[model samples]
Every structure is written in structure tokens, then in C-alpha cells.
Target: MRWGEIIRRLVLIPPTLFGVAVIVFVLLRVVPGDPIAMMIPPGATPADIDRLRAFYGLDQPIPQQFVTWLGQALSGNFGRSISLHQRVFELVLARLPATLELALLATLIAVVLGVFAALIGVQLRGRRAEWIVDGGVGVLLAIPDFLWALILLLLFGVLIPWLPISGRIDPQIDIGFHSSFYLIESLLTGRFDVANALLHHMMLPALALALPFSALLARILKTSLAEAEDQDYAQIARARGFSRPEILLREVFPNALIPTVALGGVQITLLLGGTVLVERIFSYEGIGNMAIDAVINRDFPLIQGLILTFAALFIALNLAIDLVVTLLDPRLRHG
Candidate 1:
């Protein structure tokens, strides 16, 4: 990418973030429930409620409140959680690792499986094998990812009872001052046993998140691969006695991958959104679950912080994807 284009995209990030911040701030204030009301204890007088509201600065006009909050937010101060009484930023950071780990594992699974599936679908086009793959993709896409989580939970957690049903690791294991990533910490500490347990616990949730993403990616890549297969260079390469696999590996796959990389940002957003459901079902203490709790308790600061964090992540991931796509396809660098 040209320096000018890179600079332009970077400049857009702040305005996008500000728009999201404004929307969340306004919508939360307009909603029915009062955060102060939720915090008030039983038998508390009106004066007590007023005092609490004023203390949190909720009594201020909406415009003033938004300006104040936005200013604080720019400085990385998201204020205290109304319910938890802890710093919103701190709570989010604590839970962030689990969400990132789950998202990374899910994306890895999706990319690997999706690419292979797309290759198979294109190579075996019009055959029973391709049809079967198509049917499977259709099935996966038809169902929501959370339902997949539930099905896996039922099959493994209920029927087989093989994998641990809930949580990131066994409660019995006390990993001291470790990194938030369980497997990494376990490996670093030379506790192979704990690492093994962490992997086992993670598999089901990761699989639950991966299935739909993989299916979507496969469908997109399949179309791209098929189109690339008919391109002039691919036909020319075939005419030159290039093997089928060579033509695909050299010419088609890379083109297919460009579109896949672009689609990957959307897939990641889906995975992040799906994390809320998956984390809840698995009882995983990730940011998704924390966001859910924040919403339920009407914790405005926590909710604001979570939404902003998610928005920033989504923007960053898309920008990264654009850079990757540009690198993979040199034409994008100039365009």
C-alpha cells in the first residue's frame, strides 16, 4: 500500500471509534433502567438515590455527561463499574486473554479447515465428493454457531462425559502468577500435565466457534478458486503440461487466499460476537461473559468499555487483513 493510503486508513480509526462511543453513550442513557436505581439498596430514600447519582455524575445533562465520559475515555479512563465497583479497564484486561485465546484458536481452525475444504471442493467439482462438501457447508451455515456449541455440549458434556464441560482449566490446579493464557503458562512453567488439561478443556469451545466460520470461508474460497481455475494463466499453465496440483498450488490458491483474507475480518467479528454465547455456555471467564454481565447489571462504564474495545479490535483486524491481502496480491499495493 502507498504511504498516503495507509495514512488515510489510520486517520479514519479515531472518527469511527468516536461515533461508536457516542452511539453507546446516548443509547445507554436513553434506555429505561437507571444504573443508580440498580445500585440502591432496599429501603433507601430518594435522597440516597439522588446522592448516588450525583456521586457518579449521572445527574449531569446527557451532553455534558457524554463530553466528560469521552474525554476520560480518550485518556484510557473508563471510570468504575457501577456494579463491580472496580475499574472497567482493569476488569476488561483481566478477561481479555481468554477471549483472545479462544478467538485465535477458532480462527486457526477455520483457516486451515476452510482452505482444505475449498481446495477439495474446487478440485472435485461436480463429483459426489464436492456435492458432499457443499452439503456439509450448507448445513453448517444454516445453523447458528451457538447452536453448534450447544450440540457439542450435549454430545461431549452430557452423553459421553469425556471433556470437561465448563471453565478454562481445572479448579484444582493453582497456576501462580502465570500468564493469562493457560496453555502458554503451563508450557512455560514446564507443567505439561496442566497444559494438556487446558488444551482438552479448550477443544470443544474452539470447535464450536470454528464450524460456522470455516463453512463461510470455504464457500467464499470455493467460488474464488473456481473462478481462478478458469483464468488465462491457469489455462496457459495447464496447456504447458503443468500438473493439476501444481496449477492449483501455484496459480489458484494464492488468488483464492486473497479473498479469504478479506473475508477473514468478517469471520473474526462473527467469532467475537459468538464468543458471548460460547463463553456463557462453557462457563469460560472471557470478556464476552463479562460484557453480558455488564449488560444485565446495567454497568454503563463496563458496557461502554467493552463495546469500544470490541470496535477497536474489529477495526484493527480489518486493517491488518487489508495489509496481508496487499502483501499477498501485489496489485493492491498500487491500487
Candidate 2:
């Protein structure tokens, strides 16, 4: 909340990213796989393999590789994907919008669902409805995001056949996209049909990712709401002849939201991480999905780039959340 604290956190980002880069670089090489060998065709000579390895600098020692990679990364050159043969930065940039879109949609869904559940739990306190809401949240929290993806796929994509299960959009749509953000670009260009299609395809996967986070948010908010309800301000509001709903809306909800907002920020980071599996399951071409391909192909550069990108996003999101929380909470503003 403090300017000094914000500055300190901002200053720590580089070292955090560097640590992530170092760990990923070392871990990737330590794994048993030869990216160069994978790149070479079957029956290729050792000379062919060596040439490719040297070309990608795989011939270097581990320490040299780390130094070289760190230097290049600091300079904004993440190198090319060993498998895809494209610039790692560009590849990640292209896929980033999809991941962001998915994560944002999921977060929106989560906040809405969570807030609704929390209100229901609070309003119906000591009733069966509250118990039902709590039970549902518990069940949702018990399931990981990946399993939710599978369940949603089966229920919506196969059994019900209501939504398109795979890919960002239907390949048959034949729309020209000026940007990777299909939904935004479509809506901006007055391509409502395309936008609709994009949402239809995205809905199930986004919902899958949202459910677990929604459950968590609901739990946190419900507890915060309960605590807020017991605060002296709420009793004062009641003594002032305000209705229960008015007290909740005006006095308790805002107080409850500070903690909820903090938890929401943390959940969003987890939602982004969850996209790695959910995107793959749905064949969504986000960076998370690309990360899977990078790992399978042992594309060291691409893998490293993706991890760093995610790390940066996580750090930035946490910083933004801290700022927002500080602004929202008067006590924190001074502290």
C-alpha cells in the first residue's frame, strides 16, 4: 500500500523473473531429451545432429548456456523455438491474447458466481439454502480446474452437444482476423456472428476454469461477510432503521470486498496457470496450449519464454491487486 513498498515490489520483479528463467533453463536441460535430435530427421548422421545442436547453442556447457540465455533474454531476444522455428517472443506474443481473453472471461465469471453465492449464503443464513450453497461450493472446490474442463467437455461438448468443444473458433468461419484477439477484433469490426461464435466456443472452457475459483471466492467472501455483519457499524446501521438488505449493501459488502479482492487476485493467477491444461484439453491455441507442445518437443527456448511470461504476468497482477486493495481500504492507504 505504501509507495515505498510498491517501489520495493516493482524492483524485485526483475530478480524474480531471472530466478524463474534460471530454474526453467536448468530444469529443461536436466530432463532426459535431446531437442536437437528431435529436430533432426530419422537416420540423420551425428554430424547433422551436432550441427543443429551447435546452431541452437545446445553444445555449450550448462553455466555458459544459462549466462548466454539470461543475457539474450535481458536484451529481449528469447531465441527461436527449436521445434516451431519461430521467434520465441513473437510466438508467445501471438498466443498471449487468447490466454488473456480466456483468463479474463473466467475471472469475470468467477467474480459474478462467487459474489452471487456469497450473497445467497449470507441472506439465507441458518437456512437450507445456505447449506446447499455451501455444499455446492465445497464440491466445486474439491475438483481441480483440469477435471472441471473434462467434465464440462463431456457434459456440454458431447452429451448435450450445445457448444463447440475444440479450438478458438470454427475453422469453417473463414473470417479474416487482423489480431489474435478474435472476440475483441470481431466485436470491434461489427462481426457479431464471429463474436458470437467465439463466445460459444469459449464459454464451456471458461466456465470450467471459473468454477473452482468461484467456489474459493465464495467461501472467502462468505466468511468475510459473516465477519462484517458482526462489526459495530452494521449494528449502528440497524439502529438507524436501515433494512437488512440496506445494511448489507451499504455497510457490510464494501467491508467484505477488501479481502475478497485480494483473494480474487490470487485466484486469477491460479486461473492463468490452470489454462495450461484446460487450453490443451479444449485445443485452444493459447500460450498455455503452446507450452504443452513446447514441452513435448523439448523446445527449450519456447518453454523458457512461456514460463518467464507467466511469471511476469503473475508479478504484475499481484502488484496491481495490491494497489487496488490499498485504494479500496482507507486503513491500508495510510499504512
Output the number of the lDDT-best candidate: 2
What's model 2's TM-score? 0.97
For candidate 2, lDDT tens digit of each residue in 246-293? 998999999999999987777788999999999999999899999999
Against the hidden reference, what TM-scores do the models get?
0.94, 0.97
What is candidate 1's lDDT per residue for 1-335, written digit by digit as tens?
77788899999999999999999999999999988878789999999988888877899999999999888877989989999999999899888988998888888898888888888888899788889999999998888888999999999999999999799888898767456777666778799988888878888899999999999999999999899999999999999999989999998888878887887666788788899989999988899988889999999999999999999988888788778888888897767
Q: Candidate 1 regions off by >4 Å? A: 187-190
Please give me the total number of clashing residue pairs in predicted model 2: 0
What's the true lDDT of residue 202 in model 2?
91
Pairs clashing within candidate 1: none
**Model 2 per-residue lDDT at 161:** 95
Q: State the weakest 10-residue window (summed lDDT) of model 2.
A: 33-42
**Clashing residue pair totals per candidate (backbone < 3 A):** 0, 0
